[model samples]
Target: VCVFAVKVGFQGKEFAESFEVGLALAVGMTPQLLPAITSVVLAAGAKVMSRHQVIVKQLLAIENLGSMTVLCSDKTGTLTEGIIQLHDTLGIEGSPSERVQELAFYNAFFQTGFANPIDRAIRDSREFPTSDIEKLDEIPYDFIRKRLSVRIRRNGDSLLITKGALAHVLECCSTVETADGSLADLGPYREAIDSRFIELSNAGLRVLGLAIRNVDTPHLHKEDETGMTLVGFLVFADPPKADARETIEQLRDLGVGLKVITGDNRAVAESISKRVGIMSPVIVTGTDLRQLSDEALFQRAREADIFAEVEPNQKEQIILALKKGGQIVGYLGDGINDASALHAADVGISVSSAVDVAREAAQVVLLKQDLGILVQGVREGRKTLANTLKYVFFAIAANFGYMFSLAVASVFMPFEPLLAHQILLVNLLADFPAMSLATDSVDPEQIHRPRRWDVGYVVRFMMSFGFASSIFDFMTFGAIYYIFGGDKPELFQTGWFVESTLAGLMILMVIRTQRPFLLSKPGALFLFAVLSITLITIWIPYSPFSEKLGFVTPPPMLMVIALGVTFLYGVGMEIVKALFYRYLAHR
Candidate 1:
């Protein structure tokens, strides 16, 4: 109407004609309801997720969970129980020994830093010496060195006892404890220690290398960290949760792959990954990562499932690398060191027991530290995406088809096809039925794979479905003009309003589910709302309120024609829906 009126105005008509036409034309379509519907749907999904212990801090991040293709998770607290146990203690040469536990217990027990699970385990170990130990000084754990050193007075001398990653502590030692009860040059024992480290790691035990240096001076500088004697290893075993393997398989089925990024030994990380079904053949360490350029590391990151010996900063880099490889990544962590990687991920996920910095950096938080709950969250996220797309795709296509038919009819008809108020009444009534879409049921197959929006798919869906609706709109026009004698203005408006509103409401049941409407049941509230609104929409033209709204009671014959056209239009919509989904599957 606006385009026609503008053309007429250019040919010396009054400006008022163009302005009025533009207003009527604008009121005829209600596409602006799309944003309102989207917000409600996302908010509803967030509410559902919260009941299952998944809290969505940001409304927008809820949908990103469905789109996540890669989840980079820390081994502890995510894949396994975060509780560490002192399972075994091995000497540097071969057999079980007490000196390694003696040194490790003193280093862990005398620490002034916060108590972690590993430290608690060591201090509580049965091998802890009964004798007293006093700490004179301490060097706390740092991400760069990945170890901690404590200076304690032992036998009238200060010994700097260090405990950390096996390779790191080995680098600080110049001698290794031999089976013969003597110190040997560490160079000859390097391969044996490394082999033993891998053996322990493969058994799914976290190994902390122990070393000590005798210092005559009470105070030590950074230079005094080296020239130590490697004592042995403290092996800790934090068992995997019972449901972790099942959760991993569920995420795998959903196409959300899991990767383990941990500061533990490569052997331990790989062992845990294998037990949880996230292991890949190649195990990449922080030292190995340093050898690769950024571009090479990105490629390696895509295939490697276990990233071991990763420092705090390196964990963030691995997340960034996966994202650079065109994967939407989610980071699950609960430690201060995990804060950087969590913040850098597409969806940062943390547990309820996470440190303040980690929880604050994360967008999604799990009240239960279980990956099984994450699978449920992912399903809900996909449901939100699938239902939101239903509103956008269905409403725009159906509304555009109805409006386009009105525009084409205006060129030849002598009277306005639909008055301003009549157009709004149809839009308002149709919106009532659409409100139920948020709680509507989604098909099980629809959520089997990760879902994200595709503009090309939207365009194809709208064009195909919109054209089908237009064909039926023309059928309604033919019936109104030829059979019903809708030459009268009020009669024509009444006929189209009934047909258009019924078509819009009926299409909801068909388009909302991928399967046939009868096969899947909608929520009770939704079913009740759509049925009530649909019945009320049909009764409006015949009720006394019709007079106030500029509607006329159509003849019984015309009502029959409207219902028939709607039935046929619904059938056509179902066919188009099937074809569209088939195309989507193939595409």
Candidate 2:
């Protein structure tokens, strides 16, 4: 609009001035470096994240990481040590039993189902003598049943061993074995089993019930799991990492809420959450979630921080619910049960050692399952996004002012505001500093909270700063005609060229940060790039080669006035920026 209006509005009056004003507006209004700058910043951030032991499968997800408002993390590998150890193997009487350990080993080592940390831990413990044992049939572990059944032939006798969550395993057992190798009906021992579970769980130990039965059939099925004798319990422990609490606190300070979604029972999840500094987090179980309507769960998902005993599919449900409630969610997981959740989250994060399904579904894969590394990734992501926004603010504000100034000057002045080549040179030179913006250091305040694209804020920024810049341009216009003698078109063009380039460069520095420009300095590379570009811009019009570009020597007063205007504009922008931020806050 600026170019077409200026061209048509002036062409009827003066052809030369119309051509100059139209071409200048066209060059000043277009932001040629924006797309290249955005790509460079995102690529640089991805490289930095890789240095912190993360692989970014999707480049654009880096920005999503910075924008993430909620992170749904699984308890086992992310917040905890990711190492499961067999704490104890106890008989039905809650006493350590070698027989129970032997049977547990058979089930753990011979199962055909997918292995997990618990299964690996059991196998890593004492090796049981099993030369006489022959593998037969197996019913693999499933989320619904929460158990694994393995039928084996030992000394020509077909026996089945089952192990899983206490409640589910207990349902399959008809009797309990006493410490004396005798069987008793399960009814009398129910209270004792409950007491033992409470005792172990209070200490934050995960308990799995073990049961056995003699089977006549060669094929094992879920139906054959009934009428078994409860043998013992397998206790496992995975403590929180040493830095887990600090990492959690750091995430909180960065304005990222943490939610733990695990298939573990509520007691264990609550225990780990408290240990990691999540005090009094609202807890929700799979059963509780199932009872709530989708709308109700969406509302509750915002308040609840710990989701326990959730099935594999329920993990995806929780993530979707959180997103539906208006959160940009990031999910971290490392197991088959986590694949769906990872796929459904806004940013899926998994470890390199995660199951193939989970890693494939994730956007980010860490070399180690540690929250510390993930926190570092979040910082890098924020820094990248901040630099990208800096260019946006600089280009929009400057171009807006540039085009408006050209339009206003074309109408009121007798000559063009700036020649076409002059406008392109100034625009390109002033924006060269922003090419190094990816290397600039970010203000701590800038990355303290998640950032998103706010079109309203961008528009307000452009209007406010652009209006101020145009005011400064008019000041230069007055000085050009009144002081430099605008009767000579060459003198008028040269003065405005120096003032526009120098002032544009100074404002670029100001808009890079919300903090007062002096307090938050840019990187060394950025400073050098700006200094080099500023020197080149000033030398262009005064050099012997200036004749070709329609430049003439300006009086020394013109350089002084340009510097004076640039300094005054910088000061005014600082005040304007501070007030702008304050207004935004109050609004």
Candidate 3:
């Protein structure tokens, strides 16, 4: 508006033409198609992700997933097969015991809660005649207690069995059920048992401490879980998936950092990470986290590779800290404890079988939970981001380039450089081909790592390409006046418009990729779209509506000369683009 008023003030005789030209330039600079093209490109990427077995629940996640620098996940379902198998059942003496196996089986069978993977593993690993046992009472498992207790009767004797995380279950044990069924003070064996637990954990075995005691009463409650005999360990192993190592390698190669956030202890987390080929892991245990302030943790969050032994509620804190440290964090979560973290992360990924709460909070849901599937989604995500950036680059450079050319031409030319409608037509036509950008193949090198929108990067591209475009505009202005006879303003305007439209639309191909324009082949849809715009640009000036649009058909050889200039412009832009990307590569 101000530009239009100022132009009219200076050029009172050509007031109407100045007003129209000013309006056209302002409209051209506005990113009229930004939202429209971004939505179409992102929606297209989501379909590609669906083919990779990834479902995007939130549309914005498509771009966020592409920009994710760190992914935090529990090692179980994603990095490893969720299927668990009972590795061993051992006594307090660190030897296999039938008594401990029987106790674990009975507890697994009698508890009223859902049969979890560990319970199913226990039931499958041993044969137990279920007909002889009678369930009297049970205490269901909760993450807070981290243990479940069940009281059962068999052969006229009643007993209570408890099994859960070693640290939590060990707190309830007053004695140890050593080999041969002899009970001894737990204090004598606490250190040895803890050491055994660590050793088993360090070997990547998930250990559950089993405890047993005579229960005269039939009722079982939280208070009744204490004073039991520590029977032995029920160890389970959930090895990494067949392709887990390769998947981790692929993620690293794609510049995505892996961070394990699990309920497992530091040794267990480290052990599993190493098994999956993650090296030199820095571990932050939940115990250590409990003592640290939010500020302290935020500073330390980016330094660690694993957040170990974190409680369910603390998961949100870890994600928040990473986000605060400027990471576009992607969190994989499924448990009820994961809702907060899922909602807090930049992009939350959940499995198909995830809990309802988790799935609802997540932005992406995987039909099959595997790190490899995530890699495919990331590729599609980066493609979406790349295409959008390409459009933005074209819009900024082309529009600003023409604006610069118009400002310089208006100063010396007797007539308006381009009528209002001609400049608007240029802006509209230049944007037509860019709508097909989603069909263009992105440079794999650009998407190798996470990318964020940088204003400075965009500005540099605008200035460089815009300046190159202005140079051609200057050449066209000189040619129209000296060689083509621009005594009439219509002739000069028509000549420059033809040249600017041809060169501006071609900017898409040059800025589409860092590779040389000919080397990086564009997709068929994009090529067709660009050709369509080119044909319209060549036909419009010679068409019947030329008079209404303030255009006079150029002399016989003027278009041929415009075509020659456009060719030179493409060659010049290609060289400028090559040098510009090379400088960026060095930077």
lDDT of each: 0.82, 0.87, 0.86
Q: Judged by TM-score, which candidate is best?
A: 2
Residue runs of model 1 more than 4 Å from their true location after superposition: 4-21, 27-30, 126-133, 178-182, 217-219, 278-280, 584-586
Each prediction's Cα RMSD? Answer: 2.6, 1.9, 2.5
In the range 223-253, model 2's lDDT, one tens digit per residue, is 9999999999999999888889999999999
**Which pairs clash inside model 2?**
none
Q: C-alpha displacement of 559 in model 1, angstroms?
A: 0.7
**TM-score of each candidate?**
0.93, 0.96, 0.93
Error of 3 at 139 (Å): 3.5
RMSD value for candidate 3: 2.5
Off by over 4 Å in 3: 13-18, 113-115, 126-137, 153-158, 214-221, 407-412, 582-587
How many Å off is the CA of 156 in candidate 1? 3.4
Residue-wise C-alpha lDDT for candidate 3, range 508-564, written one tens digit per residue: 888888887888888788989889888988888899999899898888677887888
Q: Lowest summed-lDDT stretch of 10 residues in model 1?
A: 6-15
Worst 10 residues of 3 by lDDT: 5-14
